[model samples]
Target: MRKPQVHWDDVEIGGELAGFDIEIKPRRVFLQISGSQDWYPVHHDPAFARKGGHEDIFMNTGFTQAALVRMITDWMGDGGFLRKLYFEMRRQQRPGDTMACRGKVTDRYRKDGEGWVEVDVWAENEREGVTSPGRAWVILPMRESS
Candidate 1:
């Protein structure tokens, strides 16, 4: 029983989720690398990334996914559960890029005595339009919903 910032009854198909912005500094990238345990040199080694023809050391796939999850979960609050999430990295997220995490409600429905919401999510960088694009399904608590 988690307390909800948003109730099932209050959601709309086209509603927007709260967005988060972060500057992709080396420290942040290091933290992401550490937290995810993804030690790919490309994530932390600029030389390796440059050797691979990338501009600079960049955020990894797992970090990108986590950003999307953070955006959805922050919007849904502790009352909700992230049932499913899917995303793709279209471009590299490098240091000095500002990552803008955004989401929009695509659908809302109830099934099996539970309330669910479908949201389209993405991370847009100032340098590149969208580095990651995805979707997520969340289970939110009902408020006088039937």
Candidate 2:
């Protein structure tokens, strides 16, 4: 199914973007690791994760990064183009945790005739608080020029 496009003129600075929730399960972790070709034991082996001082098997940073990007692009839909994305891992997202991916439009502007929105994004879990915090820039097609 095709998602509706969010035009640049429809975006408002400080507006809230649609958010999503995902459960971080062992199977999910395994799939992400496998897909990303990240074979780190801490991402799938509970015992190894615990040995590394984590409470349980945790999602890998790369997976979290990709997930966050997905969150932004998914919300922006087809008309949006990702220009830049950056994030920092603050906490571990373990299996059995529910993560809420949220973000807001921080700024909007036109550059070189292209409209862009800057977004502040984060992923939070009940137990670990903010697991990842990041920012991104997406170009959205404009309906009209100022």
Candidate 3:
């Protein structure tokens, strides 16, 4: 009695997720800074960013972290629960850059009676290649057994 919607069993190792791109604009950066209350100058002040060796104000850790979650949740849909998320930034994402969030299911298994899926995810830009690389573990709903 499996539901028609996607479930843990529906995904396979090496399966590709339908990912999305995020445009990093200055206003978006400011909004994130304000929303998170992370008043880091490197994230919002262009001069400070340059002094820190960056070309311009860049997306902060908060935004990067949230972007990863958004990509995974969007792929797994409403029934999934994100259990663990880990990532590192390799390059700065600045205004005018487009972050393409992509992922592949690296593994899937049942653990503690919960269906878990592991994905290798990355955010890339044309200029910086893979600016962020990470992995995430999510608990997706299992199909009911009849």
Candidate 4:
């Protein structure tokens, strides 16, 4: 059976969007950057990253941000538009580290005839180290409307 879609009015303050847990790997990072045509050597070259003061190549921050959007949009389904996104990089994610993305709705309201939900988002590594924290605003459909 198909699951129900989330309606704008149905998302409450403090509602949580359970996110996917991911492990960072060199190959995956390489593929992501390559596929996106973001060919910064620091994202794919360990030696270069070491010269850059990192133990190894780091995951692209853009990919991480995209993942954050995917997390909330996946829950909101197809009827939502990402309105605003802002983030701060707190720590580096090295290869082999597991990270979890989490989001919590902070407010839900209508503005300019659009249903909007503001959320606080966070990403943490397996050691409970916060890598990036951010805020997102999404526009969702009202109940009984697409």
Best by TM-score: 1
Tell me the TM-score of each prediction against the true structure. Answer: 0.91, 0.90, 0.90, 0.89
Q: Model 3: how far is 88 from its true place, Å?
A: 0.5
Off by over 4 Å in 2: 144-146
Q: List the residue pairs that clash in candidate 1.
A: none
Question: What value does the lDDT take at residue 111 in candidate 2?
Answer: 96
Residue pairs with colliding backbones in model 4 are none
Please give the TM-score that candidate 2 achieves against the real structure. 0.90
lDDT of each: 0.89, 0.86, 0.87, 0.83
lDDT winner, 1 or 2: 1
* lDDT, residue 112, model 1: 89
lDDT of model number 1: 0.89
lDDT tens digits by residue: candidate 4, 56-104: 7767778788778889888877778888999888787778888789999
Per-residue CA lDDT of model 3 for 14-127, tens digit only, reads 998778888888778878888778998988888998998878987887888888888888888878899999899889788999988899999999999999999999888988
Tens-digit lDDT track of model 2 for 16-119: 87888889876787688787889988888889988888888778788888788888888888878999998888887887899888999999998999998999
Error of 3 at 58 (Å): 1.1
Each prediction's number of clashing residue pairs: 0, 0, 0, 0
RMSD of each candidate relative to the true structure? 2.0, 1.6, 3.0, 2.2
